[model samples]
Target: MAVRHRLIRTSPRSVWAVLADGTRYAEWVVGTASSRPVRGHWPELGSAIGFEVRLGPVSLSNETVVRRCEPGEALELEAKAGPLGTARISIELRPWGDQCLVLVDEHPLRGAGGTLHNVAVEALIQIRHRTMLARLAKICETEAAEAEQRRPLGQVVSPHPDEGGPRA
Candidate 1:
């Protein structure tokens, strides 16, 4: 298993918003390009999104299906990458002060990936997770900042609606 965590300078709701948006998958998910919703509403249980993976001159279509979803909390997905096999990915968001602690856990579940899983694959996943988590953080932080900039100076918008307004 490859597990990594990042503390994003934004609310969990903010992080969830990014995860909930299927169109943003390629932005934060390493190596994927042009993500789009394919079946159902993304992030909902059983929903799926399709994306293209490019390896040099080869381009393949991969699909990720949501297996479980706890809004504003966690998302569990199964990513099918053609013959390379499927991988299980889990993302969890926990509120920390005014920010969000995001955790990502991934492992090969089936196909070539499962058969070839080893220390090298684990190491590569770790590196990919690092890049993926950083990208996620940057998106959440930048979006939060932009939202703040657009808000009236004298007003405060509660990023976490379930947690009430303003943080001391």
Candidate 2:
């Protein structure tokens, strides 16, 4: 099993927003080059997203299915990496002050990765998790910063600028 955690300087809703967007997978998930919704609605149980993992001239076709979702709380996924088999990944979000603590737990469920699971592989997974979590944090922080910019003075405005707010 590979487990890792990261503290994001943003709300759980912000982190979950990133997770909920299937197109953003490549932005945070290491090795993923691109992603697209494949079936149902992403982050909903039974929904899936297709992604490409590129390494040099090699590209692996993959897909991940949502196994569980708890809105701002947690999300569980099952990733299918073709010949590498599949992996079960669970992400939990806890509110910490004004920020969020995210935990990722992963383990191989089948195929070559499962057959060869060991300390060495676990170490590699740890590295991947470290990088992945960092990427997620960066994205969420950037999103928070951008959100701040959109609504200056920390005032929440109508998402649609066309709608006036309380007669200015």
Q: Pick the candidate with the highest lDDT.
A: 1
- How many backbone collisions does model 1 have? 0
The top-ranked prediction according to TM-score is 1
Displacement of residue 71 (Cα, Å) in model 1 is: 0.4
lDDT of each: 0.92, 0.91
Candidate 2 residue lDDT tens string, 1-168: 999999999888789999999999999998899999999998899999999988899988879999999998999999998888999999999989878999999999989989989999999999999999999999999988997787646466543334774232
Q: In model 1, which residue pairs have backbone atoms overlapping below 3 Å? A: none
TM-score versus the correct structure, for each prediction: 0.94, 0.90
For candidate 2, give the lDDT of residue 71. 91
Model 2 regions lying over 4 Å from their true place: 154-168
lDDT of 1 by residue, 14-44 (tens): 8999999999999999999779999999889
RMSD, candidate 2, Å = 4.1
